[model samples]
Target chain A: MRNTIGEVAKKFNLNISTLRYYDKEGLIPNLEKNESGIRIFDEEAVSALIAIECLKKSGMSIKDIKTFIDWCQEGDETLKERLEMFLARREALQSQIKELESTLNYIEYKVEYYTKAVTDGTEKMVKETMSNPRLLNLQ
Target chain B: MRNTIGEVAKKFNLNISTLRYYDKEGLIPNLEKNESGIRIFDEEAVSALIAIECLKKSGMSIKDIKTFIDWCQEGDETLKERLEMFLARREALQSQIKELESTLNYIEYKVEYYTKAVTDGTEKMVKETMSNPRLLNLQ
Candidate 1:
């Protein structure tokens, strides 16, 4: 049995308005309408919704995702294009992950810097430690 | 000898306007001025600029960073508050890194899914493979 848009949205923990927005944006590829003009969500529509959420969380814009959905609807002829899209997105995510890793390192440095300052009763202690010629010569 | 704003900007590969904006925003706690009223950047000023860039990249806002500089300039009395601010920001950066890592996993899954679609000449093939009763039973 198929579910109404409201039921599907509740099951997915998303707002009903979000489902309507997705349908309006053409992101919901297989939105089936009933005799009374209410939207019905089938297994295919549920799958599409899940895929859309996944792609969006991975930083794909809604416009790009719509293009990907269109390519999917076009069948085997668009397989190469779909693959290229994923490749580009994967590469971009890798770059972002690397940048975040560096940012994490900087944050860790701040954590240590502050932890010592807290222990020593003043940040000046940390600064003095860094600048002490005696400590530098010992190192 | 001190460096001009232009020299410092070029040294850090930042736009001259960014350094000016940082000074105007109180991010540079030690912007020295020469007799000609031209901004002069000494070693300490350069260090503060570097620290500002580091904190900004860690996602601190200019206004909040100005607060941090104000605390630093207030000497030992504000050490606890400054330390707490860095600790809070460090915790925030860790959370952001974790979220990005989860997003990276989703992107990796898409990469694999699309790679198979490319290999099989159609995304329908991947869907069929995923739903096969034999595969389901094995899993």
Candidate 2:
């Protein structure tokens, strides 16, 4: 099925401008156009866009995504390279998850300390409770 | 020990411009100036900057970090609100992690499918594999 830009935008819950930007960025390849010069995207293009969105959220840059797509279109010769890219990204994502988990832990600790300080109603206790070498270094 | 912006930037492997930008953004609230009005950041400021870097990587925006700092300076009354904010961010980060995980799964599936197609060397199999229902919806 072919979809107009507006229809796709509504369906995907994306802005028209973002769709246009992606098209210009070569993130969406070979879009079909009507006689009036409007973009008419088919199901293949939509699928590719979905894949692009997935890669984007995984922190793959547009250039890297374009390279991946090129490899996809090129077939067997690039399969190993493509697999390596996926594995690398998976590792990166794992690291990011770990980092975020650590940050969450720090935030939780702060929240608990602050909560205690507020309930206890003593500035000295609050200072003592909140004061930490770690807190001093936090942004 | 006080450090020049250049020294601090090099120490942190950050651009000097980033320090200036952070100063302008009020991410570092207590930065001192030297005799020539040059920025002179103390150890405490460096620690704060490190924390800011951590928060930034965890997807906190400069404005949100500033709000957090404001709460920090406001004392006990803001503790509950601050804790709520951190909790909300934790939830958001969890959702973001889930989204990334889903994307990673999708990428892994694609990579595996492509690997199999490349190994089989059958155009028919490749075509059939590419016609996944997930890809269909995206189109």
Candidate 3:
């Protein structure tokens, strides 16, 4: 049996409004409407939604995702293009992971700095200071 | 000698507007203005900017960063709070990295799927199909 939009949203852990927005954006090409105009999701629609969510998580823009869906509709003819898109997204994700790791390193350093400051009962001795400490005193 | 806003922005790879916004947000507490009202960054201001940028990179919100700046102004009395903030930020960053890595894995799976499809000149055999293939035929 086909699932209602709400059912699909619950199954996928997505918001109903987000599913509606996807439909509005024409990303859910296989979505169907019943006699009373209620939205229904068949397997293909759900699969497409799964793919779209994955792409979005990979930081693909809506425009780019729309292009990917269009390519999916075009079938095997766009296989090369789809492959290239995934490759590019992988590179972007790698860069993001690297940058976040660097940020985490700095946060870790700060955590260590504060850990010592807390133990020492003052930041005066542990705090990093300007080369010309008088500049800090100036203001 | 104190550096002008533009000079500091160039050195730090930040936009002048962003530096001004930071000063406006009170993140750069020690920032000074010359007699002509031009912004000048002393060593203390530059150091605070560096810390603010690191916190921003770790995905701390502006309000949280403003609180941190206030805590810094309060000195050693807030060392424990600052430590807890960094600890929380580190956990958040770690979670983000894990999510991105998972996304990357799925993208890699798609890349492999497409690579084979491209080699075979068709997705018919390589494509993932719904258990009930008839659902795909419905739309």
Model 1, which residues run further than 4 Å from truth? Answer: A1-26, A30-49, A131-139, B10-13, B35-37, B131-139
Q: Deviation in angstroms for A22 in model 3? A: 1.4
Model 3 C-alpha lDDT versus the unseen true structure: 0.82
Residue lDDT tens for model 1, B38-76? 998987787777667667777899899899899988987
**Candidate 3 segments whose C-alpha is farther than 4 A from its true place:** A128-139, B128-139
What lDDT score belongs to each candidate, Candidate 1 first?
A: 0.76, 0.77, 0.82
Model 1 lDDT per residue over A1-139, tens place: 4999778877778899988998999998878998899998887787787778767766799999999999878888988888888888778777766765666566566667777887888777698675422222111
Worst 10 residues of 2 chain B by lDDT: B130-139
Q: Which candidate wins on DockQ?
A: 3
What value does the interface RMSD of model 2 take? 2.9
How far is A27's C-alpha from truth in model 1 (Å)?
Answer: 3.9
Query: Regarding TM-score, does 2 or 3 come out ahead?
Result: 3
Lowest lDDT sum, 10 consecutive residues, model 1 chain A, at A130-139
Which lDDT tens digits does candidate 3 get at residues A1-139? Answer: 5999889888778899999999999999968898999998987888888778778877889889999999988988999999999999999999989988877877777788888889989987676641223223212
Which pairs of residues clash in candidate 3, taking residues 3 or more apart in a chain or in different chains? none
lDDT of 2 at A54: 78
- Estimated TM-score for each candidate: 0.74, 0.83, 0.86
C-alpha RMSD in Å of predicted model 3 compared with the true structure: 5.8
By DockQ, rank the candidates, best first.
3, 2, 1
- Where is model 2 more than 4 Å wrong at Cα? A121-126, A130-139, B121-139
C-alpha lDDT of residue B121 in model 1: 72
